[model samples]
Target chain A: MLTQTVRMLGRLGETVVKGVAEMGFAAVLLGEALFWLAMGRRREQPVRLAPIVAEMTEIGLRALPIVTVLAVTIGIMLAIQGIYTLRMFGAESQVVPGIAFSVVREFAPLITGILVAGRSGSALAARLGTMRINQEVDALQVMGISPVRFLVVPPLVAMLVMVPSLSLWSILVALGGAGVYVSSTLDMTFAAYARQCLEMLTLGDLAHGMGKSFIFAVLITLVGVVNGASVSGGAEGVGRMTTRSVVQAISAIVITDMIFVFLVTR
Target chain B: MNGVDRTSSRVAIEVRDLVTHYGERKILKGVSFDILEGEILVIMGGSGSGKSTLLNHLLGLLRPTSGAIRLLGVDITKAPPREMQALRRKMGVAFQGGALFSSMSVGDNIMLPLREHTRLDRKTMEIMARLKMEVVDLAGFENLMPAELSGGMIKRAALARAIVMDPKLLFCDEPSAGLDPVVASSIDDLILRLRDAMGMTIVVVTHELESAFKIADRILVLDKGEIIGLGSVDEIRNSASERIQNLLHRRTEEVELDADAYLRRLTGEE
Candidate 1:
């Protein structure tokens, strides 16, 4: 029993390490691709651009309402907690900066990315994974289409374009909701909270958070694509990989968020 | 077996010493066959005998480990993606489960390859889709989702999708595996009609002996990744090979009466 437990723990540790490594690799690959795009590696292909645009519209634009609503709700809940905790120390004014920084820098993007991971990322993984299992990937290959170009490239390009936009919207809604909370509960003026938000958050904070969002996007997309491409066996295999991708994506977002915080603080 | 395959044969697909593996288990073991143009080649085997694997290799769905696959005299093993695409445009495949895209309407599924591979406008694509649907006698069922259709309808829809590109070669895997006898036979008849009209080379993989005999221009029996027999239906029927005979004359699970004892009891002359 002791040996089994030890073995289980060892396996768990190895999986976590491997998961982190895969996430790092995915980020590096996306970063390299982004750099390539910057360096004019992306040639003019109007026909290929259409599908990527469609995917961006689907994964990014169509996802706004749900993401905004979820973020606002989280902001309200954070506002309540911020107010309650600040009141205990008689530091009600700090609640403004607290909610502002938390939402813009960490909470909004993290929560929104997690939500999208569970919703959109899982769907992408399942779609591609099932396609892989059902021989559709092979069918695509037989038809002389690279599954990577047809499937992976579209989603990767879409997520890279969408996540930051979604993150920005989430930040706006979260700040707006927190401002309402401040105006009502803390007896603070709306302008005062707005000014405080502007003063407390810097371009660096925005960049840091958006940077994390980009990483999250790449992580989710990569996990989805890799899990999908690696899919074999059958339905159960697809299911397993989809679950793994979503879980891995969300966990990576959290871990990377921590790393971002540590690096920014340092 | 020699240098030149019969030029008189009008070869459509020729696979030479095809070997394929799935992980550790070798699925196809140096299997080779050629399909003549405008003839139905029915591949028969028990479960896991690599019939489906061979079909996949022929269709270019799976790469062979070591073999030459020639389609219409072009070596597909070395064909570029564009060339393979051009080759695939001339062929169609109906998979085992009628793998119509679950996310699309039947009409959309039929029109997908056309839209992707051709520069046709939406109107022309729709017309083409409708024409294929009409050919499959599924004209009005275009708007139905795959999930909304019955098994036989799904099969017909899949067939419509396969032939929408006007393929010269139709590769169907287990065309009648899950359907009832009447529906299966109807599908078989449709295949025959399609072959007759299109002068298409049809390759069907099936273990259904009756279905095989019904539709086969020639049959190849596979066992343990080896071709046990390859001949016309009549040739297979008259084969003196014990394995072939045993397979053809399948013994039922129930006990049979003793012929001499029964005859003596009935007529007092054994």
Candidate 2:
């Protein structure tokens, strides 16, 4: 029994060490990515802008319909739930500011982050994982091209640009959705709802939400690319890495959101 | 073989006591050899004989447990990243599966090395890429993606990509592993042609006896992660080692069984 316990403890230690090592690798990868991008710019041989632009358009445009639908539904749900609960105290006026504050400062960024992580992040991991299995990554290395520079930096740049934009779009659409629902059902005017959102939400709230999305973007890209780059054992490895990338990205977003909320609420 | 290899004893690759391990399992055990300039050296062994591991070591893809690998006069095992990159520009590797980027056309795949490494004009790079395609007999097929091509075509396109930069040292890993006899023979001919035309020092890792005999100026036979034979094909054919002879004759090794031990094993007794 003692030996078994020790063995189990040993396995746990190994897992911890491995996790720490992977995190270190991810940090170093981000540093190398930024360095390579700067170097490429300095040499006037920047990583293809075409791919970065394509990735951005792909992420934002392909996700637009789903993000819109989800945001509107979430906004409407918030209005319905908030009014129903607050009507007990006859505090219906609180619903507008409540929706505005929660949607901007919390729901929009979280929803968009989880969506991007599940959709784009998983795809990124799978693509790079396939490239690894196909030995195209090795071929690039053999040809003196750094795969990190060529395969990674463009997507990293794209995520940094796109995620925050999507977050902003989500915030607006969600607010518009809540305003519509509230104005139609309750005695509130659409303009008054809009005015309450403007009055209640400071620029600090918007920045805070955008900042959270930016971090989430980094987390998703890092998890996807790093998992993809390290994949082994053929096609099965790619599939496993893609799943892990999504899970880790979502978990990272939630944990970061918790921290952000704790700091702000305190 | 005498006239075909115009190699002048220039050691393009020199390995001394190469050793590698995965966790606790030892893979390559003190392998040492020299690949002369402008010659085709075929590394032959059965599955898990460590030829693939050795190839990865030679390519500097894996760090050795111990020993040194000097490629083109640079000790790759100890070379700095900048130096390694400089050395890699002089090397080309065609993997077993061709490994052409699936997203790119064959033409773009061939031109990738040129585009990334050289400041040459796009027109010049295209011409250079086309020239390689013609050399590999893949002319006019450069517009197709890797998935669009047949197996043989993909291998030829990969060869075109490898040779596009005019690398001095070329590595082909199991180049003819999965192909029809006719196509495999053509790939062997292409390897010979590349060596003759470009004066390249080529290292081919393959277990295909027929292809090895066709292209190898020197054959290095590995067994259980150790070098059992390294000589001209004629010398290897006449080798006295039981393993070498067994490999040449395609005969499985026979172990004399002891009845008592067999009975013990059957009875699950120590």
Candidate 3:
């Protein structure tokens, strides 16, 4: 029994140390990428614009339909739940402010981030992992090009630009869904619903939500790129990293969202 | 078996007391050698003989456990990242599997190094890429993806990309590993032509004796993580070592297993 306890403690310590080392490496990679972006501009080696545009299309534009569907469903469900609870207190009209506030300030960005993390983050990790296995990353290195600059920067820039845009799109779709449901069932006009949504929303709320999405974007891309760059063992490695990228990205989004809520709300 | 005089020829690469380990097992054991300028040096070894490990070290892709590797007078084992990057620009590597970017056309693959390192106009880069394609006998196929190329065509295209920058040193790993005899010889011929035309020192790592003998100016034979012989093809051919003879004649090493140990292993007794 004593030996078992000691072995368990040893394993836990090893895992903790490994985790800390991995985090340190990831932070260094992120720092290097940012440094190159800041300094590469003055050197006339700015990140290429073409790949950024392509990645934005892949991560944001192509993701519209699914993000819209998920956001709308979430909005309708929240409205139903809010109405059920508010009707008990004779405050059914309060449901509008409640749904609009929650969707804009929290649900939309969080849900969109989670969905995009699952979709685009896994794709990026698998693609890069396959490239590493194929030795194309080594080829780039031999040619004097940093793989992080060539691969990570484009995705990083695209996520920063697109994730916030995607969150905003999700918020609009959710609001429209809630408005449509309230118009038919609750004695409210779509114009009134829109006005209430706009009235309940402050510039600070919009900025705060968008800021959370931006941070989520950075977290997802960093996780994916780090896992991808470290892949080995051929197809099995790629598959493992792809799964790991999604799990870690979603976990990071949730944890970051909690931290943002605590700080921004305070 | 006349050796090139170290005092007469300039050294392109000088490795001394090199040692490398993966986990607890040593991969390269204190190997030392010098590659002369403008000579084709072939590193020949059987499977698990550390040929690939040494190649990776020479390319500065892997750090040695203990040793020095000087490529064109730059101590790569201790060089900073920026210095290594600059050194990499002066050398080129053709990987075993071609390693082309699947997303890009062959033309873009060849033009990548130029676009990254040179300020040449797009038109000039295109012309240069085309010239390399012609030299590699893959003209007019640049717009096609790497997946569209045959085994031999892929090797040729990768070679074109490697030499497109006119690097001072070139490294080719298993250039003829998976090709037929005819195609393999053609690649060997192309390696010769590239060296003659570009005046670059080349290092090739291969287990194919015929290919090695055809293109090498000097041969280094490695066995079990150590260099057993280093000389011209004729010298290696006439070598009296039983290991070298076995390798040349394709004889498997004879092992006498202890019956007790074999039984224990079979039963997982260790």
TM-score of chain A of each: 0.85, 0.97, 0.96
TM-score of each: 0.83, 0.95, 0.95
Q: Give the whole-model CA lDDT for all candidates, comma-separated.
A: 0.81, 0.91, 0.91
Can you write out model 1's per-residue Cα lDDT over B33-81, one digit (the tens) per residue? 8888888889998778888888877887777888999998878778875
Ranking by lDDT: 3, 2, 1
Query: Candidate 1 - CAPRI tier?
Result: incorrect
Residue-level lDDT of model 1, residues A19-117, one tens digit each, is 688657666656645543454223211136777888888898889889989888988988999989988999978888888888888988898789878
DockQ of each: 0.21, 0.61, 0.67
Residue A208 in model 3: shift from native, Å? 2.3
Return the top candidate by TM-score: 2
lDDT of 3 by residue, A136-209 (tens): 99898888888888998899999998899999999999989888887777889989989988898899888888
Say which candidate scores most in DockQ.
3
Fraction of the true interface contacts (Cα pairs closer than 8 Å across chains) found in each model: 0.26, 0.74, 0.71
- Better candidate by DockQ, 2 or 3: 3
Q: What is the per-residue lDDT of model 3 for residues B1-270, given as tens digits with 9 covering 90 to 100?
A: 123455688999999999999988999999999999888999998999999999999998888999999999999999987788788888989999999999999999999999888889999999999999999999999899999999999999999999999899999999999999999999999999888888789999999999999999999999989999998899999999998999999899898879999999999757
Ranking by TM-score: 2, 3, 1
* lDDT score at residue A70, model 2, on the 0-100 scale: 95
Q: What TM-score would candidate 2 get against the native?
A: 0.95
